[model samples]
Target: AQSVTQPDIHITVSEGASLELRCNYSYGATPYLFWYVQSPGQGLQLLLKYFSGDTLVQGIKGFEAEFKRSQSSFNLRKPSVHWSDAAEYFCAVGVREGFKTIFGAGTRLFVKA
Candidate 1:
């Protein structure tokens, strides 16, 4: 079975500090990986995604991620985080057909001023 895992339940970081959110996935083959953010009651927004090509991918809101096929991990990173970055981050894996996506439990990010 395919699944996504976010080891961190919550993370607190000071404004302007760098942030890294870990994500791991288990699948029979390399699947489409994604990073999404949900702010409060808002819908999940795509931060970044990896399907093929370069392992490093840039995303919205100063976010970036690197996909490691060996480790089956796709970690999200930010050089500088803002207070507005506080939100729930989810790591997901999906298939090209039907676009069925499975999301991780999610990691809540807390930004401190």
Candidate 2:
């Protein structure tokens, strides 16, 4: 069975500051990893994914993540954040042969001006 854990339930960041969200997973095989963001009253959008090579992967809105196999971690990072970036971020692990996905509780990002 595959599972994911997100330590932070919420985070606040001043506009233009850096951001990092933690993630950890447990799976028997190589799992499909993904980070998604959802704005208020909006659908979730894919930020990035890790399936194969290159431990570090970049995504939209100036977001990036590094997949660490040893630590079973995949943490999201941003050099600088904007007020518009305030939203709920979820760390999920995808499994083959299933349409459903297991999502973490989520980290709600608050952007301060």
Candidate 3:
């Protein structure tokens, strides 16, 4: 069974502070990992993905993640977060099948001025 766990149910960051979101997973073999962000009423947007090759993966909207196989973790980071970055973020794992994807509960980001 594959699963994704986001330790923090929610995270709060200052408008210009650096941010990091944690994600851990349990999978049998090499798993396809991804990070998605959902703004207020919008659908999920692909923030980044790690399908192998490099441990460090970069995505849209000034986001990047590093995959640590030994730790079974893929954490997202941003050097400086903007207020517009506040939203729900989900970490997920999928097989080559593409249909069997498991997503974490999600971490809602709140940016404070």
Each model's C-alpha lDDT? 0.95, 0.93, 0.95
User: What are the runs in model 1 whose C-alpha is more than 4 Å off?
Assistant: none
Mark the 10 consecutive residues where model 3 has the least summed lDDT: 94-103
After superposing candidate 3, which stretches have Cα over 4 Å from the reference?
none
How much does each candidate deviate from the true structure in C-alpha RMSD? 1.0, 1.1, 1.1
Superposition TM-score, candidate 2 onto the true structure: 0.95
Candidate 1, 43-107: lDDT as tens digits: 99999999999999999999999999999999999999999999999999996557789999999
Query: What does candidate 3's lDDT look like per residue over 1-113, in tens digits?
Result: 78899999999999999999999999989989999999889899999999989899989999999999999999999999999999999999996565788999999999999
TM-score, model 1 to reference: 0.96
Model 1 / residue 98 / CA error / Å: 4.0
Worst 10 residues of 1 by lDDT: 94-103
Q: What is candidate 2's lDDT per residue for 1-113, written digit by digit as tens? A: 77899999999999999999999998877878999999989899999999999999999989999999999999999999999999999999887757547788899999999
Clash pairs for candidate 2: none
Which portions of model 2 show Cα errors greater than 4 Å? 97-99
TM-score of 3: 0.95
